[model samples]
Target: MRCLWLLGGSYLAAVDSARLDLSQVAKDPTPLCHEDIVDETCELLSAGRNVFQRGPSGKARVLSFGELQGALHTTLDSLASYMDFIDLDPHRAGPFMVNCMELCSLTVASLPLTHRPPAPDVACYTSDAGVVCDIDVSDASFSNISFDTANADGTNKFEHSTAVKVTVEMGNDTVWSPDVAPVDPEDRDDMPENVGLDQLRISVANLFRIFPPFELEVTESKNLDDVSDPQIVEENGTDAREVEVAIEVSPTHSPTDIVGSGDELELDLSDHEQDDAAVGAGTGEVASKRKRRASTDGEDSPTKRSSGSVTEAAVTAAELRSLLGEHLREIKMAWGDIQDRVTAVEKVTQGHKKELKVVHGKTKVLDQQMTAVKAKGDATARKAEDLETKLEGLTSKIEELGIKNQATGDGSDPWGEYLARRKEGQPGRSEGGEERKSLSEEDQRSLILGGWLADTKRSIIESEAQQILDMPALANFVDTNRVVVFGPRKSFGILRFKIRDGETAAGVKARMWEVVNHVRQNKQTLSSTTGLGDEGRPMWASFLKTPEARKKSAMCSMTRRVAMRLAAGVKTKEGAYYNEDATTVAGYDVDWSTGTVWSGTHKLASASHRKDISRNDDYQALKLGWVDIRAVVAVTGCDWSEAHEAFQHEQ
Candidate 1:
């Protein structure tokens, strides 16, 4: 009888020899016995656990040997429900199922087990096979199996629990005893009796009876009597008498030996022969027999033969030597021709080497020319930078004179004059006293929107002020006091400064333009001073725009405020923010809605009232400078439409 051991759905051992006597196995603690097998299996399981524990975060929860054995028992019991028993007889199902459970229980009992941690009571239900106990191992219930050190600690130790539902069924009925208590390893007196060796032998016997070991035999055979008949042919035609022969000459043998004496030359017919005379004499007899047979069969009778034969012809030693000499002469002539071809190839190779040297010399000259051109290019760049510096100095001087003349002549700021003319409904004039062309309302609005505000809070504005102060050409002429920084908030702020002493606002603005050009040219200096590295946003300094431009910007800010407020309301009601097209207030589009009072208050509720604005449509629109003023007026009301009231009163 053979023995097959299966564990965890895989074959553990397959012994083809005679089965061991259980009586002897029990008397002696052999590795083949059931008790030793269980111990070996436990050792393997412990090794597997150790492997599973290793990870980047360190070892997982370490399970004691007893706890691991208990988990194995529980896992096997659960797997029994899914086992296919179609190959077994249903009539013997009671004994077969009992043997399976007994075999599993006996193996687990043999282990030096310990009590597992108290597991939550599992709820089971009856299925077609039996009752199934289920413990939810979902991520929500059990922490996800993680190797991340941050998530792998004592708090997540429960994630390694081996609790599983066990299903035990009898013939056509579910058999589970609620009263049956689990084995207590700590209390030896309370523990169930250890299975005796005789009981273990009986369980093994029943297991083999129910599930016999598999065997396969293969054989091969052949028949020797199936032979094919040979065919006989009559030779009526005459055989060809011509014979072709070849002679091989050893390189060590002398040509004089070939011509000196015929007796010295020997003919070799068989390649395997050590002696040339023996091979020649044997081959000559065979040739004589074939010739005699052919001559006797000619015209007198048709000879019948089952197979063909080989015939050899013997040549005189003198003739063989002559043939060998002719072959040697041809070989010498061919060798001479090969030497001539090789010499011609060497000559062509020498000519190619000479050409390569000439090309290499020309390459060196081109490299030298490139080095000289690069040097000239560097000198030209230095001269261009010097000319730029001189031009900037001349421009600064010219602006200083213009500001002095303007201040003395008018005693009025150019920007203030321009605003005054607009207020009086008169045409404005430029700093040069030239009348400016009339602009359309759209063109005027475009200018207002495109220009920067005097008190705008933008990082670029602050960065520009830093760049201007850091410049070597302007640093001495314009002090920190002259570079007045202004804004509603800290950090990102505005800049306002006159370029020269006694400079009118127009002259200061003109000089600022010239300084901006210098700043652009020295970008590395500007970036370092502003703390705006190469990867940061672009920066430049300029004179402040008209008040109208500031008002337009404020209006745009108000529009964004209204839109943001509407988005907040939508988010609060629907639990999600929406874009401008989807936002609605009081059953109307948010962009066209009038202000609505809060439910508990009579005062109007607007976006400005809320401090936290989510990154919704309005927030993104503000970043891109796309807020609409009409939407602001519709939602905020005309009372707050004026730039001064909206910008000043609201934060």
Candidate 2:
């Protein structure tokens, strides 16, 4: 019974062995392997999920295993719908389609692929018959093939050159359920019930059945009687001559006696002649006695000829049947031998496949290793190229400097002393050492000055930065503060004090340098300056260098007026406390019980507003060279706001 699975169902049909044609089916290019289908279904599902997960929120959520499985089924159904053929039937469908449906149905029952992870390893291969799928994708086609042709005995006749060691296991669900706990590799069994393996075997068998390796067909057809005819022509084209000779003598001999002999018996023409004479003599006496013998001889001749024809026909039919039977038996034996060979070939192919699988696994491992090695090699090559470039630049600089490679009169290379001292390094080198031996006087001075400037700037900046960071109130004024050192130009090196949002550039610099100079004079590190942030200590003392009389005279009249107002028990506006004119500078205590205000001889708000204007005064003068500083720029974020407001007020 031949059954084809098509359109989601199996259909059975009776087909003639001789008339079964697979030519049209073999031409089909459709990929119906179970593994291919599953892989495509998985890929499609992943693609759809990626599409659905993209959102304006920029959040991508991947589907869970159950969700993915559902998607997989949907994808498969969609693919099948598009792939369905209207003209396809049991006879019209290819073997690939039939076997794919059969194998996929069986596999789905066992695997179901429920809760399977994404990217299941699935692959397939094509053979003459149909597609063979390795759902687990553990193997590939045989890489190196060889046959043991010298085995005269049929044992291991087409076996692989190498022996394969295959270990099987039972009672392990993980072999079938890969997403679950893994099977113990140490477990052993001769034959295990592995669903994937069984599916593969069934698929292979079906493939072979659909496309057999060998076939026996009738080259020519003829009747048994036609086969019995002699191949070569007889002499004179007369078959009747031998029959006539037999009829003349064989009346006395029994036909049944001659047919019984199975040995090599030749016809004796001499015995036939002797038998004919004896029969003729006996008949001669009867003829003489009767004068009517001539009439009787003529009447008996036709009857004798008719009996001879019947005997010849019987002999020919028996010979034809015997020959036909022998040929048929030989043909059956040959066919049985062909079947054995096919089975052997199939076994060899299976062994090769197993070995090929091992090779494929090794190849994948090798490819991964190669990828990692290539990445490392590329990184190392880039580093080497960069190092080479730097070396070339340094070499060119050295050449431009005219530094000779020759040994000095003291029997040492010019750079040897420096190299030796460099190898035995210290925290700080001596001024008299070979450290600057190769440098000219100016270069040596520049190197020394530059190092000193960097150290100085680092120490000063560290102190100032620490102060700003320690005083959280300073955060309202300073965004960033650091020291930048530049140049050993011909003479002196420079250290630029940089500050962001420092409206009072000179005042900030004056304060910063004071801390730096104190540290230098005291021979103390930046961490030792704990007095810088003291409440009464003034670090910006240089910004306050002004005439004492002018500072006192600016607000003396206002101070006196505020004092009088408080003395007279006058109530002052709340906002007037911040006025530079000092609306009420005297501190007074109110006596509510007596309904009177008592005045104290002191100021409420400073009449000069020294805290606000002192820094602004110094900042204005710093632009006119009241302070000696260079490369200092205070980038004020509110510079325009302050200036624009002042302009508006003047207008």
Cα error, candidate 1, residue 461 (Å): 22
TM-score of predicted model 1?
A: 0.20
User: Model 1, 230-321: lDDT tens per residue?
Assistant: 11112212222111111111111121111111122122222223222211210111111111112222321111221221122223323332
Cα error of candidate 1 at position 353, Å: 3.7
Worst 10 residues of 2 by lDDT: 284-293
For candidate 1, what is the total of clashing residue pairs?
Answer: 1
TM-score, one value per model:
0.20, 0.17
Provide the overall lDDT of each model, using Cα atoms, as 2-decimal numbers: 0.32, 0.29
Candidate 1 RMSD computed on C-alpha atoms after optimal superposition onto the true structure: 37.1
Runs in model 1 deviating more than 4 A are: 1-329, 332-339, 357-372, 375-379, 382-390, 402-651
Estimate, for each residue in 287-347, the C-alpha lDDT of model 2 and write its tens digit.
0110011112232212233343321112231232233223223322333344346557977
